[model samples]
Target: MSVVNPLVRAEALEARAYQLRIAEEAIKRNTLVVLPTALGKTVIAALVAAHFLYNYRDLKVLVMAPTRPLVLQHRDTFLRLLKLRPDDVQVLTGKYDPEYRLQAWQGKSRIYFATPQVVNNDHSLGMSLKDFSLLIFDECHRARKNYAYTRVAQAYISEAPYPMILGLTASPGADREKIEEISKALYIEHIEARTEEDEDVSPYVNPVAVEWKLVRLPESHRAVERTIRRMLDDRLQRLSAMGVIRKNPKYIFRSDLLEAGEALRVRLEQTPSPEERGPLFAALVLQSSALTLYHALELLESQGPQTLKLFLERIKSSGKAGHRAIVSELVFNGVYRVLESSDLEDHPKVEALEKLVLEQLSSNPSSRIIVFTQYRDTSAYLAARLSKLGVTVVRFVGQADRGQDLGLTQDQQSLLLDRFRSGDIKVLVATSIGEEGLDIPSVDLVVFYEPVPSEIRYIQRKGRTGRRSFGRVVILATEGTLDVNYLVASRRMAERMKKMVKELNSELHPIIRLGPAPEKKPIPADWIARAELPPSSPETAATTFEAELESVEKERRAKFNRELRETARRVLNSVLTAGKNGLPFEELCTELEEEGRNPVAIRSAVERLRAEGQLMKKEGRLFPAGVEAEIPGARRHVFEVLRVQLGEAILRVDDSFNAILLSADYNGPRELLRRGNRFSAISEIYENDKARHVRIYAVEELSD
Candidate 1:
């Protein structure tokens, strides 16, 4: 094992003395380290890993993280800091060949950075974890029951001769139960919780004061919120009675509880004049979906014809009578009844978001910002509105493949991040996908279009900002709805976290203050000009030519209607039988099920083939469908869920609109289908989660 220079490795030692000291002490004993976001928790992991690596030359160091991205990050960091060669460090993720990974595992690689799932699967497959000297759990807070972390930790403890485990995270738990649960999962022997107040931490960590601002819901909206909350309560009771949800289920049994709230909304629509009913019904729908009344009002006002159009389309495609019924009630009996009577242009939150964007832009013209919203339709709505204000805006999303539309992709996410990093784009309007370990470009601000309930979400959102220096965060809340409740909940969570950290600290603490409300500014009428660049340059021409050639080849192949193509279903089944680790078997089965194919049959065929040795499995639970040398171009069709909006918009299907365009030159129906083609959209409707807009039409679907 290659060891990094003692002097160079020690440089990180001085940065966070308290964290390092705690980590060093903990290495001698099993430890749980809880630090807040941006607290350099990764640094502590590295320091401990380094200590183990240098001290125990006979055993390897294993770091188990929660996600592939986290694994990659840890692996890359260790390689850079410890000056280890790539080959010397093994990163086992769901993307690797399991057999290959096991072979490598049997070797002398000193450091193994992997997702817990990989470790668990390998151990299940008879691979041993006994050789590793140390086990580091990143995001140790997540090591609860049934998670892969639990299995891996148990196996390591059982098998390893020297069981040295280090648990790391920013937030271990909001309350004591969660913290204790985490400790038990990692078999933690000691707890080291540090705060910004500690003498050693004071210079490196800054205290942040959390402020809660309540935006009262208009009386009209407050009544609506109560009615829906009551409705959700009733449905929860029904679900519990049915055994679909047991008592104290982690979350509600049904995923679409908000949709159930529409029953109360129908009652509200019955009593209103066109003017009073239309807007009220719209507000009711948004509130029922867990959106703040403030946010709903903003959407009702600012997002025009297209917004309502998307809503109607989603219901129609879903084949869900309830959606249609609620929308009908809203329009005929409630808000839409008043659409002709009231002006949506004068809505307040629309004006507030607009003002917030402009003020931030003008003040920090050079600072990039990311605005997050709950719905794809809403994100598009905000992006369009912001673009009109002259700021360059990109909407980032995760692509959904099972439906007619595709979601944003990893590539689009990466491209936008790159653009933001290079100052090419000024603002990014994204969804929850932007909240995690994505290389989100440093931003000057984070604007929450609506507040979310998860404590993890709250930290991830806030953590996006204030990374380099003091950054601004804006939460847009609509008055008199769940928006107020959300604001209070988020503030309470942040405050609790702060207090927890302070209580855990070793020194005098100073309270950190949240930023004050700044003056709002209006969006300029002609703020943005179309981006200017020479069209169809050499690179562009080459790409177009290559695409055209590929298109022609696909067309030629489609015309032939080869036997291979006809038997692709059988072939895929055979491939699956031969291998189960690659192509995410469950995901493929789910996709096939969505396509109305018999997943059981498909699964059976794959299982049959696995006994035949035509397919092979890889380390990361990745099952490449065919043999590497014999079928080099064998590809697995992947899909992304783009945006969910009104049903019939053409631009939503445009390649440019997708954020998850990781694949190069995908087969798009738009190429072959004429205008107004009546083909199915890529994915099916969920009727819940707001029917995601698009699906990745299988390459075969394109030909059909």
Candidate 2:
């Protein structure tokens, strides 16, 4: 049976008893609805939203998610199910300028979909939530702590005259205290929770079969692991000797190291004598080094040798004292030599994954699969490995760019998911970014490259499958490693979460409304009139929305470009005036700040000028591009080799600026041009397309 209501479209939402029951309870009070993924959590929210809209035509609804894509997803869902005009339902994100968002907030939109951060920012800037009758927090597990959800919920509860909250999540958390914190934060008075095994939910859920594939680390890999373990032990022992940490090296956990570091920092802050502060500072460095080593060991044991190699490369390039210490000690102990000379291509789990994926696809050619990993490097490796074996695969990660690893933009991510849905891509190798409220139906198989310790992530990953039909989950783990421990921990925690929710649900007493229930009102005559009015054309409304969005984007870009150009002009002129002596970077920033220029804009302009070759930096000083040529001696700087072209090698400097090194000028081995390799070079700067380009006159490979 389908839900029937004026706001709801005809035969739009198939009525489910559990969802209706949950929504009925939710409408009367602020509630936290905990249901399994692929269930109707969103549907429950939509039904409740439709209820409020029908009964209280004068009030508005605000729905918030953590990400922009999720926000837009909710908007699409609402538009499809509700009879509201497009103009009456609005979506807000960080993409819109503050002024535009302000206007949108003040507009006549009856329902709003937005990300929490944007809403919190707007609230801070005086956007009121007093008119909103219902506030829905999607992924409300994030409400605890200082997350934006908590802040926004506080504001909405305090300001809205008739406040009502609906917090939604598949899994709140395994920790009872954290769940209670979320409840307190969101003002949750009741809980509506269901499981796959629940009477009502069982009939709706397709059974998802879960299997574990365990692999043993090769003996050669263990040798390398032993070396890293030795390094970690040395640091932990030193920390213990200094009284900074009390745990024995063999039994110490990462959390203990973190706590010790914090305690030592506090002790150092209170001490006045430099003599006493010196040992505390040394202990801090040792603690930091121990933490780094701990992480390195985990990566090697869980992710594999290749991922660890990448971590090591990043550490070698880092300027932090802890990072440098780890590199020095590892190199001294021949760990790098062993890793470089080892013939291991990947961890044994990779092979297990390959077998599982091949078997699944072989059995069902039309199946869609998602491979979830904890690290971007592992995602790339798995995607490339599968692609090499003739599988259609793509790496789906978040939008933050690492040193050389670029993430997919929102548009790109949406497109990739569309392709996967349409059977154009068979496998999606994703990081933690894919483990939220993304609605990807018909995913036949979900693979966990490594078992996550967090039960929330474990539940989310398992939920990705078994949506439309029977699904399967394959978790790859290494025997006698953190993989097994994490796997067991997540499972026990998930059980505990279920039990906790059940007890909490039983304990909560429903709140009775202080006044009579508001009478359901008829559809507003103006809304009916607007719905009756014919569109100017078939594409008129969509075109209008697109045009408006485009206009906002153009305005934003224009404003940014104006500020960037003005800042760049002033910064470049000031630097050029200083001549060959160059100006200190901080001095230039102080000068721009005095002029009242935006500090962020000033930084962006300087980076742009440096990239364009209009400006150059050396040893904490800025100079005009090509000023290096005026110096008599060779000026060498280390750079990470990005890639090699026909006659030049592209290199990254200071982990920000990109430069080119011509083959004719470089006198280093060709192998030095390999990506991820580092080299020092004496470079000349030139300008092309008003952007700075670096020309290497001399090069020397930096030893690991």
Candidate 3:
């Protein structure tokens, strides 16, 4: 390790010839650098930034990562490596005020490290990229579609005078098209990619022993798998009957169900006639159910039995009838009720994982290991199961708040990582969040709970280890499950990604330089100020007029309010005067109609009365909020269509009816019903052979 010159610092960091060579070439062009992880990618970025600053003294540099932790990590690295004033390096995140960020960008910062989202937001608010000389995008494979990286890159290309983008990633992707898209999005031309096998990198690379531990499903677990398959088959057959499927249920996949559901929604939107829309909606319901059933079976078969149970519970509580029905069959009053006891032979992968983890601990006691699972439930289950093996375990998931164990806030994740780094935590059982850019400490072992089919994920997970020292990577797979395909696909894709990148570089020449550099201009004082919105549109003008009219109408409503209160009293009197319970909804609307009252006005007054606790609604009739009406079994027609759903025995009201009930049922559904579709006053219109006109409305249509 030696310093190049007095301008750059970090003499402890040995300047690798390969890194310097690539960084030197990449600095001149908008490039995408595909370096294997732990090969000093950040160092190359810092070197490029220092060179840019040295050559273009007036211009600043912006480096972007995907997460705040990574941003902080990169900023720290730059501060240590680049010889500059401490205040010149700034780390911007969402936590920073917009005004504060804009001021910092103006001059307070020379090298800015930030999350892509924050950069996009600030740019949107008038912060110009012209100030920046070099834009380094870390984990740039994510710069696709509407991602903030793509938006920010576009801004840099269009806004900057001499744009140079250095896109960095461990592996861009398996597919040539996607990698090409990333390059195009970032305006990338030259690609400097190096593998561990490359002559320049061979000396610096640490060997990682990757092992595949295969497990076979026991007969007892297969028994559960058989039952789950049968239940799934039944649902699929029902979906086929609904015309949502043309193929056999056995052949239906998640993608197939999703495609059919999407097609149904599109057809429903395009179909002009309401009658035609109904069938599409019904087909969508079946497609949605089939999708749910297929995934549930996948979880049951591949992701251990406990994950399947938790999934079912979550879906059942969600009030989606499709999942609830299958769950009910497995839980209560079904042939395969053995799942009630937890002692059945659990997933074989879980057992195999425990053995490998114990073996790793025995081989190296102080080693830190990360076990990556696809589901939070699986992670939690693995953590619990592994804890019994006398190994320290913790479930590390993302920031999304799902139940309790599923959520790990940013702060929580940081603390856990710190503990794992210092060897306070022996093992980390993590979800997809672990694959993303986070400043994770080098691990002794990286285990894939299940082989992921995606090349990006596969590469990222493997990159976790073999950085600082010799590391071990174990991929656990069920012999006959999707893991087999995923394991094979991952290898195939990793190989393809390299070939594709090499082919792309040979075909597309790097853009040497984009014209002459423009002079640095003074940033306006108002750049930090809030953006002013344009004048109001016609819709807003009409809304304002309507609001003013409503205000004046409220003044006129002084007289109407008195009449409505008096009318409400009369309705109460009628209720008391009439003996049995309260009037039926039909009779009530009829009585109000005879009195020459506006139906909407009458309903508004009734709602006002209900708010004041003067009346309540029961069985579609006004009663009292806390008090039950004297309505008997023969009293007001209660319908009880949705109540049967809660009871779990509603036969005709299957998933199709439940999907309708989702919009027109009760509580959440009842509110949706009240706010009916725009076309008609009918709360919900549905085809039903049991009702007249072969159609039914959630709330019976009010008589004219």
Candidate 4:
């Protein structure tokens, strides 16, 4: 085994021939590297970073991922591989003050790791990208529409003086249109795609034995499914009778319902009179109800009765009557009785999954495994059931908390993944979050709780195994439901994506040819004669030029600071005047900004003060040490509830109320969806603790 680097060797990661070839292509061109998971994608990223560093000592490289965990993962890989100085590499997340991040972007680290959102935000706030010579975008398939990836790519082209891009993903996309969109968005100059089937890759990849574990819905389960379907039909018929939905009620589907609701919402926005909205509002009620019932039917047929029950609980908690009629029908038709049963009879797939898991465990005593499911509720149920079966289990989910679904924080997720890697957790029941770029140790087996139609997700899920050794994968499918359809669609899409990228690679073109769109033709001579104004005097021209230059300078100063140290000094003096009670943290940052220091520079100054022991934090306030008046305990104040109004200014809601913090992302009415707020809008969400420590991992939201 040849050593790849002094820091990273074959034992850490075996650099294969295919990955080396891809890295060679990446360094010379702004290329998209598509390799299957467990194929050293990060190794290629590290290799590319090293090339940029060695070639251009003065330039920096920026590596971005979509989530904090993924960012940290990438940062760790680079740190382990390259022997860089401590300050040479930095990881930036939303937890840092905006000012500190901006400074990092301006120029501080030779190698930087950050989430795309943070990079996007700093760029928007006037941090220049000209200093970054290379940008490595992980999960490059997400670079379409208004996603942060697209915006960053646009800024990189316009702002960077010597820009080179390396877009990385396990799968670029599912279809040709999406792949082309990603290519255009990132201005992908070349595509080097590899899969497990490639000759070079096949030698390194383990043969994963994939099997379809099919099960038929029990009679009782089918009864419940039919009853729910009937109720859904009733709701759709109600909408149809009102002429709100044109589709036949009997054949209406979940996608159709979603499309109809969106259409009605658009129409409602254009209508002027309240009288025209009554029928529309009533139709929306039916639409939401029918959709809820349809989902419940799907859960009953595919997931199991327990998942359906948990889903029902969520619907009732939503407090929207859309699921109310369906719930009532469930009780009337005796479906609720079946739902209350703890038996696996209602969900045959659960029994089949249990048997498969047991068989794998019996065959191999020490095995790591992951079970992928569609819903958080299913994850919870599977974890409970599996634990009862004597399997150590945990539920892994995303950062977006929905209703009773308390999404895992980034730090919490990191810790859980660590435990799983350490064998403290035997099995992980995971939702869509687990399908992303976050790493888990190579598992002996991966079980799909249900088939998913989205090929991107399918590839991610299947790629989890066959990393370290020959792996086994079991997919559970209900005989006659969408599960079968999903399995086929995923296979078809994956094949198509691979074929399209390979074909497109042959006709690769440079990004320069794609950009700086044609300039407008010279104005017609006749039109110029009619519209042109008289030339200005030299004095007048200089005055106009000076005014324009002054405006530009003033704006530039607003976004950056050359006197960050001086501002920090002034901010400290202002807080000292507030005495022992001290100035709130926001007030301190505000004072620094008034002194012309941005968040990035102001934070650096504060850290210097903190390190020197001149600054003290007490009761959510900052003050100089050795002052009078009692130091307020940051923990002394606690509230059970809070009502926060929507506003442009940042609001830090701190209290002892743990429930409010957990349920902050909870939704109510149509207001939550429409009144969009940025992450900084609500700050400092804390969990209730006698420890009095603030929670940094919790992403704050206003659920109430």
Rank list by lDDT: 2, 4, 3, 1
Could you tally the backbone clashes for each prediction?
Answer: 62, 5, 1, 4
Candidate 2: tens digits of C-alpha lDDT, residues 219-333? 8888778888988888888887777777787788888998998899899989999999998888888899889989998899889888898889889998989999889888988
Q: Which candidate comes out best when scored by TM-score?
A: 2
Clashing pairs in 3: 616-623
Q: Which parts of model 4 have CA positions greater than 4 angstroms off?
A: 1-13, 236-251, 331-334, 341-346, 402-405, 506-508, 513-567, 571-704
Q: What is the lDDT of residue 463 in candidate 4?
A: 84
Model 2: how far is 211 from its true place, Å?
0.8
The TM-score obtained by model 4 is 0.72
- Tell me the tens digit of each residue's lDDT in model 3 across 96-142: 66644654565445678888999999888778898788899999999
Error of 4 at 485 (Å): 1.6
What is the lDDT, from 0 to 100, of the residue 160 in candidate 3? Answer: 76
Scanning candidate 2 in windows of ten residues, the lowest lDDT window is 695-704
TM-score of every model? 0.58, 0.75, 0.70, 0.72
Candidate structures ordered by TM-score, highest first: 2, 4, 3, 1
